[model samples]
Target: MSDQKASTRRIVVGVDGSGPSKAALQWAARQAELAGGVVEAVTAWEYPSFYGWGPAGFDFGDNAGAVLTQAIDEALGPDRRGEVRQVVVCGNPAAALLDASRGAELLVVGSRGHGGFTEALLGSVVQHVVQHAECPVVVIRGPAEATRG
Candidate 1:
């Protein structure tokens, strides 16, 4: 049996079920493989407000966890699934992603997202995470088709 200590360097990746996020997952997987580390695939979600609703009405208590799990499965597939752990948090996407990145060795995210124009500026989750994460951040844009399978 090998005696090498398993690396503790964690990689946090933000995924929103978009093409660019998928590309980021792929890139993060390669990095995890190289570093002998695991990837934390995170997805932050918030429910649309209902008029004058109470906390119970607006609560997304367990839904976020399910969403994050589904996203990780869709992004990583069976082959790379074992290398990733899914994380879900409530609140703003950028804030959640950045908070999750606190102790990470590297935080990876896509350059764009489902949020249309908001993502055009620094409002992009990737941009915000890169700017605020305590660790190194990597933004992955979808590769040219020539590089894709």
Candidate 2:
């Protein structure tokens, strides 16, 4: 409804089934709960293009959706009860997050996701969104054990 949409703040978060991402999701959910907003969990993916040829039999979008669901279940527990909104986009991660963050109150992402980096900070997607997001951005830095899911 228009009333719900107008009253609810929209907090967008990037999820990739990784530790940092899960941490981001948890933070985003808590922020949304405190602010009476909805967390828009976004997951983006792209088909592998090898030499201009794509895979013959693969549903990348479906797989991405499944992964998103699992990540949500893992991060937020099983009974969300519609506390979060799930969004799956088929494109570049930064682009998807930027597009989803339009008119959003806040954009949240992990310091790094699914990357082999415990020493360095700021993954490419986080950097891009932080530099280019229209809304405010929050980068959650988890513990070293956050490398695992």
Candidate 3:
């Protein structure tokens, strides 16, 4: 029983179709491989609520799952892509990642995301996760040279 428990390890990573997020996923995958853990690559999406107009103004046409999948594919490449499991949800990115972190050995996210300000050191989502994640969190940052390591 102890051996079985030890063999089962999970790592949660957030993806947003950004360069940093892709790097984060790569980093998490590398870490998972080293630690013998499974990687849960998650991406969150939320439709804008258009008050009045009978909801016709709002567009739910965007497919968040496809974006996330493309990010994963681009990061991992054709080979070894199956090592990571893709997950898509509807909510705030930080909250989604935090929720997924439950029962996970680690939670990984990019230092900054797509909508983050260039001058900012850390994005709001990263800041939120760092403050509130239930498990240990890893923030992936820097250039490709540094991130790939």
Candidate 4:
């Protein structure tokens, strides 16, 4: 339907099952509601490999899909999930997000994801996407946790 297509603004968001990612998803959903846009929630995963072992014959594709689904379910919840389109791809987070963001009006992502450094303000993936993505990027920062004085 041309009417439906015309009314829908396309928003792409990255989700990695992290707290900030959840916040990003919520923000993206709210933005979509205000703009009458549809959100594309993307999660990127790579094949699991062990250095010591040669091959485990693990089903990484299924696992990747499941992880992406879980992230979407957890982030969007039931009420907002219908407004989002979920995508799981096997690649780097930045590349996947960049690919998904083509022709999108906006791109949203968490400031930090499942990175090792807890003190990091920005994850490498987020930084890469911000620099490379064609669309405008919105980085969602999670609420500050209470710090021990």
Candidate 5:
């Protein structure tokens, strides 16, 4: 009998439809495959200001959750879908991701996101999560070749 025991780890990855986030998801999936771990793909969203007030106000929380779920599903297709658990949280992206990172073996995110130049230092979510999360964090950048493409 082989001495190697099944090693299971919990990996948390944040996704928001950006190229870098997509890269992070792909990297996280490969890591999960290697370690025999489960991947938690989390997406955080909040109500849009336009819908937060007035007579036409709509509760965007559920919609946001649904969008997040879709994004996670797209990231992990049929073959690897079994290893992923999708979570949609209502709050600031950075705070939600950081909160979710507790006790996780690895927390992965993109170097940049949909936030644009306002988040130049490091994408806000990645920066905050890296500063506060208890687990080791991985920030994936677009491939060097892809940058030129």
Candidate 6:
């Protein structure tokens, strides 16, 4: 029973197809491997908010799924990729990560300004999750060092 309970621990990670997000995923995967827990890689996409400017026939869900898969593959590589679980949500990134991280042992995310002011420290999603996540959150900033020890 204790063993079952231990393995049930999940480390949730938010991936946004960004370099910082990939670093977050890598860090989360290493942490999960070290702690004997599972890694849940999550990504979110929102429907086009423009009233009539949406694309003709593009499926955002599919695109999101592809992005998540690619991120996992690139971050974890082939040897460790199969160990992490993947999830895609259709909504705001911050809300989706928070919802998915419920009951998780840890929530990991990235912090790099995707756009806007270049001097900003944290991205909007990372800032929101850091403030509001139910679990302890780890924010990866800048590029991950070469194989962190």
lDDT of 4 at 119: 50
**Candidate 5 colliding pairs, count:** 0
- Please tell me which model should have the higher TM-score, number 4 or number 6: 6
When 2 and 4 are scored with TM-score, the better candidate is 2
Of 2 and 6, the candidate ranking higher by lDDT: 2
- Model 5 misplaced stretches (Cα beyond 4 Å): 1-8, 53-59, 113-120, 143-149
lDDT of 1 at 98: 80
Give each prediction's root-mean-square deviation over alpha carbons.
6.3, 3.3, 5.5, 4.7, 6.3, 5.1
Query: What would you estimate as the lDDT of candidate 3?
Result: 0.79
- Candidate with best lDDT: 2
lDDT of 5 by residue, 7-44 (tens): 44778889776567767888898998888788878887
> How much lDDT does candidate 6 score?
0.82
Per-residue lDDT tens digits for candidate 1, residues 22-95, read 78888898899888788888888876676356565445646667666666667677666336877777678899
Measured on C-alpha atoms, candidate 2 has an lDDT of 0.86
> Sorted by TM-score, highest first, which candidate order results?
2, 6, 4, 3, 5, 1
Model 1 ranges with Cα > 4 A deviation: 1-7, 51-63, 113-123, 143-149
Alpha-carbon lDDT, every model: 0.72, 0.86, 0.79, 0.78, 0.72, 0.82
Which of the two, 3 or 4, has more TM-score?
A: 4
Whole-model lDDT, candidate 1?
0.72
Q: What ranking emerges by lDDT with the best candidate at the front?
A: 2, 6, 3, 4, 5, 1
Model 4 residue 113 CA deviation in Å? 7.8
Itemize residue pairs with steric clashes in candidate 5. none
lDDT of 3 by residue, 70-144 (tens): 988888898873368778888888889888888789999986433325535578999999999988999888464
TM-score of each: 0.72, 0.85, 0.78, 0.78, 0.75, 0.83
Q: Residue pairs in steric clash, candidate 3? A: none
lDDT of 4 by residue, 1-149 (tens): 24543456888889877777778888998889888789888888875466335456666666777876787778677676337877888888899999988778899998743334565557799888889998899998865541111
